[model samples]
Target chain A: MFPSRFDLVVAQTVAEAVEAKVDAGEGGRFLAGGQSLIPMMKMRVAFPETLIDINRIAGLDAIERSNGHLQVGALVRHADVVASDATFGAVAAAAPWVADPLVRNRGTMCGSVAHCDPEGDWNSVLLATGAEVIAQGPSGERSISIADFVDGAFTSTLGEDELVVGLRIPVPSGRSGGAYLKLERKIGDYATVAVASHLELDDSGAIAAAGLALTSVNPINTKVADAEALLVGQQPSEELFAEAAELAAAAAEPRDDVRGTAAWKRQVVRTYTKRGLAAAAQQAEGS
Target chain B: MEVNITINGSEHASDVEPRTLLVDHIRRTVGLTGTHVGCDTTSCGACTVLMDGTPVKACTVLAAQADGSEVTTVEGLKGADGLHPIQSAFTDDHGLQCGFCTPGMMLVGASLIAENPDPSDDEVRWAISGNLCRCTGYINIVKAIQTAAARVAESSNGS
Candidate 1:
């Protein structure tokens, strides 16, 4: 199926891309990986009048660790992340689970997060890690927290003329670990229920910081704030994790779909959250 | 807009619409039908091609997106000899039944072997997990890839 016709501007720089967006005036969309936008266009669900192609823009593909944050550029593909040495915490764990190998070759991490699909995996990882979205607009560059950046399903607080330049995921200063637990029907399928868990331990082996987020079981990538609150200051144990898992499952708003009944999915959420937290704790201890 | 794409080592420059897909460009404009289109929604790997030495779903990539990149399609998998090692391995091991998904599978296998000369069975399975085959169950396909890896290794060692 061919997409509806649109004018294409191959932006050579970020400034040019922003300018093009301003000219298109709400009808322009930046084409990063085109993995998500192209498919939506083919289905005629999205028909932007102008597309600012950012593939030619330079300096937007770096995956570097600097200033105590792992900065993933907008052009950083999922395959790049899996092969990079700079990833950590939930970012590294979830990179390989973003999609199948083929799709991962062309899909970008920032684009996936910008698409704001509740089923997308990277947002959950970013939410769980308390990452920031680096956005460049006509005014200037700014950093927005992941929690505030994601407005809803398939939506973000990013302005119309702004383009996401990168994602800043803070590097854990202490003993920390993370795991992305996903339940998919197949390799290329979206998660029926996925959990992203990150844990930091203090000197006394108590939970210092905790982040828990659920995917495919909520209106948006739901950060389990209540569950995270329960994890902090507590010693990692089966009982503690079980209570946190129960709270996480209670936060899910899964709908009955072909994957399974809503009740079954919520149960899966509970089980995965518990299991993911255990894996995180184990990794943290090992580290 | 004009896109100058290097396909199979030859430059095929053409003016295409902004919405034209890379798969359509390769199949229709370049006339290399070896790359089949299946489930154009990026679910199937029948449209897989090596864009700049990485396997990407062509149907999901716009022709304009691949403007300056080097693309290697199924038609490009050939050595100085009659057939590439992976192609011969597929023939020797009865890797294909209907051959609809053969091109995509071969491209992915060729890519996997290039990166890893001696991949384990699980690696081969994981490499081609994106490609789906309705027939032949996939045992023979995996065998073909492993056999190809061995043959390629033997040839390189002997040389």
Candidate 2:
């Protein structure tokens, strides 16, 4: 399979990449790992007239903790995330589950977040971790919350000329834990249904901060705000988790598909949320 | 666009279209047919090759993207000392039946041993999870990698 003919611009810097995107207009795309975009191009699902290859751009592959966030650059591959000591919570848990070893070697976290596929794991992990996408355009850079950055399935709030330079996931100052649970048919397959859970326990052993997000259960990566709200100010218990899990199931807008019936998927979401939260709270307690 | 890549220790530079996949470039341009293309999609690792010593699906990588990198296909696995240890283990253990996915399996296995000289059974299984083998049931494939790892380790200790 071959993609349609397009001009390739190898950019040396972030400014050059943004400039190329502006020149290429709406038909242009910034090629990072090309794991998803290249396959789409081969299937003729996407026909970009120009491709701004940002692989050569230096300083866009850093994985470091700065200020109060774990900063992942646009070129930080999934494998890098798995290998990094700095990664924690859902980010580390979901890194090995993205595609496979080969795909993970090249695919970037920023690109996955930008792609915003409902089945994609990184976005849900980012959403649960309260990550931010750093967008760079002709007007300069600005940080957008993961909730606002993901506009829809396979869509984002990024402007045509704007490039996602990196993603910043907030670091938990207190005792916190995160976990990503994905149910896939086989290795490298898209998730049948996945859940990302985060928890931070207060000094009183109650939930101080909580985040819950679902994948492949809605048109977009859905964050269960109501469920998260239920978790906060509550003690860790099976009954408390069960109530929050029910709320997560309620928030799911799944459709019947070949993977499984909508009801079955929602059930899995409920079960996974409970299990994920328990595991997260266990980690938090250990921390 | 012109891409200059070193395959199997040989430098082969060519002019290719931006859409040209690295697998197509290796088989057609460089005439190295050892790397098979089972599924054009990234699902199957039949087109797996070592790009800068890291295994990646060749069909999904643009030839232009691998412009200045060193790629190692199945042909390159043979060291100065005859066949690679993994290749010898595969033949000895009957790791392949149809031999279609052999090239990809061997490359990934070799890569695994390179990074981890002594891998667990689960580690071997996880490493080759990307490559599919309808034959041999993956039992012998896993055994072959383990055997090769032991052989490599023994030789290093003896030396």
Candidate 3:
């Protein structure tokens, strides 16, 4: 099926792209990899009058490690994330779990974050890893915390004129490690329920810090603060992981869908969260 | 819109609609039909092609997006007189039953071998994870990829 008619505007720079978007008003959108947006267009779910192609724009794909953050440019593809040293914690680990190789070849992590789909691959990882989105508009640029960036299902705090330029992820330091684990119906399917856990261990092998978040279990991918708090100052143990998993399950607000029932998803999240924590904790110990 | 794309070894410039998918452009414009569109959605890798030497789903990419870029379809996988190593391996291992998914499977397999010359069976399966083979139960497909990896390494070493 062919998509609806639209004018394609290729922008050479971020400033030009933002201006074109502002000019096109609500009917305009900045096209990145177009993995998500193109599918929507093909389904006639979205019909933008103007698609500002930013692929030609330079400088948005640089992976830089500076200022205690890993700045991943918006154009940096998911495949690059896994192979890049700049990405740390769950974002890198979850890269392979993203749709599949074909999609990951072009789908950018910032595009995933910008899409803000409830079942998106990057949300749980970004939320748990405390990543921030860098949005650039006519006025300049601003950073929005991932927790605040993803407002709801398929929604973000991005202004119509603002384009996601990049993502600044806080560099996890010290005995810190993160992992993303997902349960899907098939190889390339979206998550039935996914968990991203970042754990930091103390010198005594006790947990010093933890960040837990789950995807597709709520209106938005959300952090399990209570579950994370439960792991703090506690030694890593199967019992501790089980308790945190239960708490994480209780924090989840899964709804029934084709994947499974709400209760079933909650249980899935429970077990996956436990496994994710164990992986992260083990990495922390080795680090 | 006028878009220029380098397909296989040829360069083509064509006027296309913004909505025209790359797979359509490759098949219709360049007349290369080896790339199949099993599912227009990104879920199926049937339309997978190498864009700038990386595997990307053609249905999700617009012809306009491939402007000034290089695309390699399964048509480019063969040698001058015989089948490509991956294609040969597929035929030898009986990797396909219907042949609808074979092109994609072979192209993805080639990509996998290009990236990792000696992929394990698990690595081969992971490489073709996006591609679906409804026929042959995927056992032969995995065997085909592994065999192709060996052939590719052998060819490279001989050269």
Candidate 4:
């Protein structure tokens, strides 16, 4: 199916893009990798009267480490995140399971976050890492925490005039690492359930700082705060991990969809969170 | 919208809608139809093409977004007098059955070799995960990629 009629504006800067969007009114969209948007548009699930092409904007595709954080520009594709230098290690671990090579080559990390699909793999990891989203608008730029950026599935806290410019993630300060574990029905399919785990070990090999999140289990805001709280000051052991994983599963409020039943997803969340936590703990131990 | 795209090492100018997918432009405007569209969504690699030397789903990329960028389609993989080594490997290894997924497999296979000349069987499988082939059980597909990698390495070494 073809998309509805729309005009195009090539934006060389953020201001121009925002202005174009404002002029185009509520049906305006910022076209990035188009991996997610175009497909929806084709199916008539989404329609924009105008598209502000942000690909021409310079300085929006750089990945850098600065001021104790890793800064990923809005145009940084998943392939770039995988191949480029790591600001945080876990985003790369999740890259392999994000669609496939072709989609990875074109899909932008910021785009995925902006789409805010509850089933997206990046949200769990980004939320787990407490990644900050940077957006620019007529009123100037502002940063939204990943926790606050996503309001629900396909919804965000973004102002209609704002465009995501980059994402900032804190660099682990100690013996720390992260991992993204996903359960997909097929080799290339949306995850049934995914977990992102970040752990930092103290001098005694106990969990110092930990972050945990879940995706595809619905509610779009599936943070295991208690699960994370459970790991801190706790010894690294399979029994403890299982307890936290069970808590994470219990907290999930997923709906039954084509992916899986709510019960099945909860079980997956329980299992994968443990696996993700274990993987992160191992990496932290190695470091 | 007007687009001046550089595809297959040649620059061509055309008028396209802002909604025109790169795959359609490559097929309708430039008339290079080897790039198949198995899934209009980004799920299938049947529409894969190298945009600035990186494999991307052509069906998801807008022609306007691809303007001023270099693209290498399956048609561009042939040598002056014969099929590319990867294509030949497909024939020898029986990598294809229905042949619908061949172009994408060959193109992505070339990219895999370029990125990792001696990719392991697992690596080859992972690289083509975006593409789906219902024929040959993918055993020969993996073998074909391995064979192509060897031939490509041999040719480069000889050169």
Candidate 5:
């Protein structure tokens, strides 16, 4: 039912994909997994004159570790992340909770982040993991922290001519634990509200560092630094969790939509925040 | 645009519009209708197929995007003598009532079994979570996979 005309060009490399997009000019889009782009195209929300298929690009589907960081290629599928023994403990624990297995198999990690959907499951996790996004343009490659990479809802600092090449996640040190919790209205719908928490403990088993991010409650996934601050140096306790949850809820300015009301979202944020922090605390204890 | 893709281990070249979805290309040009399109959006896994050995929703993938890639549809699951073990298990275990979601279920199931020959009920559930089924309530589908896994293990041991 959607009508549009476009040329398809399969690019075998990142340079070729970029060149194709530049040559196509203002009306070109890169086709990765097409999990997000194709549906948007069918809905007529996004119409591009040319589609540069980047699936055949080599080295874009690998996941490896280097320099105390985990590097995931832009084209790595969510399923790949979920299945990998190296990254699966973190990614698998969260991936199956995404839309579904089919989408996970085709949806690329970079595509999800680049799409910058406010309710995306992985965005906040990426932020909580202290990941960096690598983008390649005509000039060269430049890396930006996830916090600086995403600007707002459905938007990023990425230039039109630039494409995301890969993501770099700093390896967690010491005793650290991370977890993602999302509240969805249905099985396949976007998260109405989500929380990602990372806690690192010192040798004394006291909280040394904490990272927390909330999604679907605002125009962008935001880290609740104040809440993280509330946990540092404190033992993981119900009272501390309640305090962090309260602070996190205060930080979020949720919207009222068909899925939920602002008040309900606030309640959920508070509830999920506590739960997520508690889980992160337990994970940190094990680490 | 003219795109060539290998479907079920055979390469087929066709002249298709850039807008043609891989699902449509397989159903129309390649004459394989086992893959069904359940939803316009990629939310449903009714059109699930193995693209380069990964189970993906064919509806979301454009035919042009699938160029030079190998795809496996449900119709390709059969062996020389009979149906694939999973297919026979689905039949013997009464995995389908309406059978609309059967192809996608089988494709996703085959992909799962291929990866993990012995999958737990939860693993099977997780594997086919993307493929939705209104009939059979997924109980028998899970049973079918369990049966297939046992059969596959038995055959492998026998051989």
Candidate 6:
């Protein structure tokens, strides 16, 4: 059972949800899927005096392709996104592997993004894909790129009364492919180290652009721009991938934990980075 | 607050505490005890149910959040004629020994089969990863899901 007692307000609209939070002032917490918040409450980590349930708000759970990008509503569950045709194959693949099936069914992309756990799979994937977060506050709606939205672990740029309304992922062009790989000690646990890689190929089957982001290695998801730069203008041969993986390993700043030591995590990051990039390169070639 | 929700295709209105979870509402107020609460945290799938046709853990969802939604518990999965195919498969394959996790396993498994009737073994394993069963070692549970998938596919084809 949860420790704190709070008023439950079922908001019928986005406006109502916001108002409920504003009215509750500092004591209110917005509840979407509650995959993160409820667990915290049960552990006495969070003790909000009021809970604004946003599940009833219409038009907040949708996934569609729009204007050459995938626009996913905030309430769209991880399971729905994984099963939906709108998300690109690589992005969809990340959803099923997040936590477990029940969590995937209830956890939303926005919720995971907002939670901003260092080991969160969605956060790492969003960073690699250069996705944008859409936030709505009492004043108005605003959009922030994923890089700027996540400040650190368990933190985001969202204001007290702000809500994440949606996410926008730009579709890569011309034989682009992406993949996410994580090293977990066991199933349904946070990743010890994870990497999400996206590669775009030129007409000559050479890498045109690449994005690599590592999670659970630092306080926040870190984009290894230097490592990604190594892949450009080159094919993903074992030698090239080795260099990129080395760079990613060098760039990471993993911490010691029960799952693994910093050195072990660095090694896992290097290994998974190489594997993910290799697989992504194959997917790019096929495309 | 007073919330009106449709459970198992029946309308129910109950006055609950503000902090009451949907799992408690279903089990206590609606008198459907099939949905068990295994972990207070959201890690366990013992409280799994379908809210508006999507599988979600009831323990995490507040009852007020489900105010106007259509909820389907394990009890709701049965037709007037007999048990749902997933439930039948669980029995046929010996998916449960203690049966504490059976309700949630059935709910999540049914949802998985509903979405992908021909899930691979890997997919079947991935689908029920959240629902933990200590007694069965998950071997028969996986077989039960596959069995249910076959049954559902056959029934749909026959229909």
Top lDDT prediction, candidate number: 1
Task: Give the count of colliding residue pairs in each prediction.
Answer: 0, 0, 0, 0, 0, 0
Question: Second chain only: TM-score per model?
Answer: 0.98, 0.98, 0.95, 0.95, 0.96, 0.96
How close is each model in CA RMSD to the real structure? 0.8, 0.8, 1.5, 1.5, 1.9, 2.3
- Model 3 reaches what TM-score against the true structure? 0.96
How accurate locally is residue A66 in candidate 5, as Cα lDDT from 0 to 100? 82
The order of the candidates by DockQ, greatest first, is: 1, 2, 3, 4, 5, 6
Compose the digit string of candidate 2's lDDT tens values, residues A87-191: 888888888899988899888889989999999998889889888999999999999999999989999999888999999899999999999999999999999
Reference-based TM-score of each model: 0.99, 0.99, 0.96, 0.97, 0.95, 0.92
lDDT of 2 at A211: 90
Q: Which regions of candidate 3 are displaced past 4 Å?
A: none
Q: How does model 1 fare in lDDT?
A: 0.94
- lDDT per residue (tens digit) for residues A1-287 in model 5: 33277888889889999989889888999889888899889888899999888988998998888887878898998878876766622344566677788888788989998999988888788877778999999888999899998899999999888999999887666877777888886677888898888888888888888888988988899888888888889888999999999998998899899988999999999998888888888877876
Tens digits of lDDT, candidate 3, B44-132? 78898999888888999999999999888999988897888899998899888999988888888888888898888888888888888
Off by over 4 Å in 2: none
Residue runs of model 5 more than 4 Å from their true location after superposition? A1-3, A88-92
**Model 3: how far residue A139 lies from native, Å:** 0.1
**What's the true lDDT of residue B32 in model 5?**
95
Structure candidate 1, residue pairs in collision = none
Q: Rate residue A72 of model 6 by lDDT.
A: 90
Instruction: Note the DockQ of each predicted structure.
Output: 0.89, 0.87, 0.85, 0.78, 0.68, 0.68
- Chain B TM-score, model 2, reads 0.98
Report the Cα interface RMSD of each model, rounded to 1 decimal: 0.8, 0.7, 0.9, 1.2, 1.7, 1.6
Tens digit per residue, CA lDDT, model 2, B1-159: 889999989999899998899999999999999999988888889999999999999999999899999999999999897999999999999989999999999999999999999999999999998999977459999999999999999999999
